[model samples]
Target: MVASSTSSRSIAVLNTAPTQPSAVETFIGNLLELVIHSIEGVRGRLVGGSPQR
Candidate 1:
Protein backbone atom coordinates (compact mmCIF):
# COMPACT_ATOMS: atom_id res chain seq x y z
CA MET A 1 0.00 0.00 0.00
CA VAL A 2 1.09 3.56 -0.63
CA ALA A 3 0.30 6.60 1.48
CA SER A 4 0.55 10.29 0.84
CA SER A 5 0.28 13.56 2.67
CA THR A 6 -1.09 16.98 1.76
CA SER A 7 -0.39 20.49 2.86
CA SER A 8 -1.46 24.09 2.22
CA ARG A 9 0.52 27.27 1.79
CA SER A 10 -0.13 31.01 1.97
CA ILE A 11 1.59 34.34 1.49
CA ALA A 12 0.20 37.34 3.36
CA VAL A 13 1.42 40.88 3.03
CA LEU A 14 0.88 42.65 6.35
CA ASN A 15 2.58 45.99 6.12
CA THR A 16 1.45 49.33 7.48
CA ALA A 17 4.26 51.50 6.30
CA PRO A 18 3.19 55.11 5.83
CA THR A 19 5.29 55.44 2.69
CA GLN A 20 4.65 53.29 -0.36
CA PRO A 21 8.24 53.42 -1.50
CA SER A 22 9.54 52.10 1.81
CA ALA A 23 6.96 49.35 1.95
CA VAL A 24 7.76 48.18 -1.57
CA GLU A 25 11.47 48.29 -0.88
CA THR A 26 11.00 46.22 2.23
CA PHE A 27 8.92 43.64 0.42
CA ILE A 28 11.37 43.42 -2.46
CA GLY A 29 14.30 42.94 -0.11
CA ASN A 30 12.51 40.15 1.71
CA LEU A 31 11.50 38.47 -1.53
CA LEU A 32 15.02 38.62 -2.90
CA GLU A 33 16.43 37.15 0.29
CA LEU A 34 13.96 34.33 0.19
CA VAL A 35 14.82 33.51 -3.41
CA ILE A 36 18.55 33.61 -2.72
CA HIS A 37 18.21 31.31 0.27
CA SER A 38 16.03 28.86 -1.60
CA ILE A 39 18.46 28.71 -4.48
CA GLU A 40 21.38 28.16 -2.15
CA GLY A 41 19.58 25.32 -0.41
CA VAL A 42 18.74 23.63 -3.69
CA ARG A 43 22.29 23.99 -4.94
CA GLY A 44 23.62 22.46 -1.77
CA ARG A 45 21.35 19.49 -2.12
CA LEU A 46 22.30 18.97 -5.75
CA VAL A 47 26.02 19.22 -4.99
CA GLY A 48 25.62 16.61 -2.24
CA GLY A 49 23.76 14.31 -4.63
CA SER A 50 20.81 14.13 -2.23
CA PRO A 51 17.23 13.80 -3.41
CA GLN A 52 15.19 16.89 -2.66
CA ARG A 53 12.56 16.31 -0.06
Candidate 2:
Protein backbone atom coordinates (compact mmCIF):
# COMPACT_ATOMS: atom_id res chain seq x y z
CA MET A 1 0.00 0.00 0.00
CA VAL A 2 1.28 3.46 -0.86
CA ALA A 3 0.86 5.86 2.01
CA SER A 4 0.91 8.91 -0.22
CA SER A 5 -1.83 7.66 -2.46
CA THR A 6 -4.06 6.71 0.47
CA SER A 7 -3.52 10.07 2.10
CA SER A 8 -4.55 11.83 -1.09
CA ARG A 9 -7.67 9.75 -1.34
CA SER A 10 -8.58 10.50 2.26
CA ILE A 11 -8.09 14.20 1.65
CA ALA A 12 -10.36 14.03 -1.37
CA VAL A 13 -13.00 12.30 0.69
CA LEU A 14 -12.81 14.95 3.34
CA ASN A 15 -12.97 17.75 0.81
CA THR A 16 -15.91 16.35 -1.12
CA ALA A 17 -18.31 14.01 0.54
CA PRO A 18 -19.61 11.49 -1.94
CA THR A 19 -23.30 11.49 -2.66
CA GLN A 20 -23.31 7.94 -1.41
CA PRO A 21 -20.62 7.26 1.11
CA SER A 22 -21.38 3.56 1.19
CA ALA A 23 -20.07 3.11 -2.33
CA VAL A 24 -16.78 4.85 -1.72
CA GLU A 25 -16.49 3.21 1.67
CA THR A 26 -16.84 -0.20 0.07
CA PHE A 27 -14.09 0.58 -2.38
CA ILE A 28 -11.76 1.60 0.42
CA GLY A 29 -12.89 -1.34 2.52
CA ASN A 30 -11.86 -3.80 -0.19
CA LEU A 31 -8.25 -2.81 0.37
CA LEU A 32 -8.26 -4.61 3.71
CA GLU A 33 -10.03 -7.61 2.22
CA LEU A 34 -7.30 -7.99 -0.36
CA VAL A 35 -4.56 -7.68 2.25
CA ILE A 36 -6.15 -10.21 4.55
CA HIS A 37 -6.68 -12.62 1.67
CA SER A 38 -3.04 -12.31 0.65
CA ILE A 39 -1.83 -12.87 4.21
CA GLU A 40 -4.00 -15.95 4.63
CA GLY A 41 -2.75 -17.35 1.34
CA VAL A 42 0.89 -16.86 2.29
CA ARG A 43 0.32 -18.31 5.74
CA GLY A 44 -1.27 -21.40 4.25
CA ARG A 45 1.74 -21.92 2.04
CA LEU A 46 4.14 -21.43 4.95
CA VAL A 47 2.30 -23.61 7.44
CA GLY A 48 4.41 -26.69 6.71
CA GLY A 49 7.43 -25.13 8.50
CA SER A 50 9.73 -25.64 5.51
CA PRO A 51 10.16 -22.76 3.08
CA GLN A 52 11.19 -25.07 0.27
CA ARG A 53 8.19 -26.15 -1.74
Global lDDT of each model? 0.61, 0.74
lDDT of 1 at 26: 84
Off by over 4 Å in 1: 1-18, 49-53
Q: Using lDDT as the measure, which candidate wins?
A: 2
Q: Show where candidate 2 strays beyond 4 Å.
A: 1-15, 49-53
Tens digits of per-residue lDDT for model 1, 1-53: 23332111111222433456567678989999888878888997879965344
lDDT of 1: 0.61
Candidate 2 RMSD computed on C-alpha atoms after optimal superposition onto the true structure? 6.1
Point to the candidate with the largest TM-score.
1
* Residue 26 Cα positional deviation in candidate 1, in Å, after optimal superposition: 0.3
Candidate 2 local lDDT, 1-44, one digit each (tens): 67998889877876797665678778769988888877777887
